[model samples]
Target: MITASRVFLIVMGLGFIVLGLNGLLNPLGHLAPYGLDYQAPGWMGEIRANYGGMHIGIGVLTALGAVHYAWRRNALALQLVFLGGLAVGRTLSVFLDGMPPTFALVFIAIEWVGAGLALWFLRSSN
Candidate 1:
């Protein structure tokens, strides 16, 4: 019986997978309404062209990891790296380069809270 928390995490993870893939896959225009500067990074021009698949994969794994956390809490550790990475990336985005108010802030907050919860869930097995 998956509780509300599990469902929330699953859905949240699934959302990221879809959003990230869309941004990476559809580079013709702004995939995120708030806008993502894929070119902000070093060698972005070289990377962005071929990075959509990676984003999609991350998104898929994020949702799967959340489910793994819900069903098998121990597996949350596997995703900790990703959650931590996301937090760092967003922090860098906000600090080094300017980010829009809408999606960027939301992503940062989600990454922070999600990472914290993932850590807590992994620590306690009750």
Candidate 2:
């Protein structure tokens, strides 16, 4: 039962889990390179809650989708929305705000690819 979908779910889930944990444990170190810094104490809490908690939840749910048959489609849908949303937002920023950092450009490409894969798997499974 080691389908590509399962592998993708596991990989993406684990990746998000790691990222979430990093964001939680070291928000500044994790995001400071991206020009995001804590302007106030509340900023740390915000990043820890939104980026850390939300991503951890996403990761757990995604990994669950891999192991639970009933969750597969829903999990794929989650990937589509999450990755697609990021791509859309970033793309919009490029048009409205002009070019961003090279890293952001790279992230946009990766998010699109990930969203495409999620969509492909979602459709193929139907």
Give the clash count for each candidate. 1, 0
Question: Which regions of candidate 2 fall more than 4 Å away from where they truly are?
Answer: none
Leading candidate by TM-score: 2
Per-residue error (Å), model 2, residue 120: 0.7
lDDT of 2: 0.91
Model 1 TM: 0.62
For model 1, residues 100-124, the per-residue Cα lDDT tens digits are: 5876688778878877777776666
lDDT on C-alpha atoms for all candidate structures: 0.61, 0.91
Candidate 2: residue pairs that collide: none
Q: TM-score per candidate, in order?
A: 0.62, 0.94
Instruction: Rate residue 96 of model 1 by lDDT.
Output: 85
Candidate 1, poorest ten consecutive residues by summed lDDT: 42-51
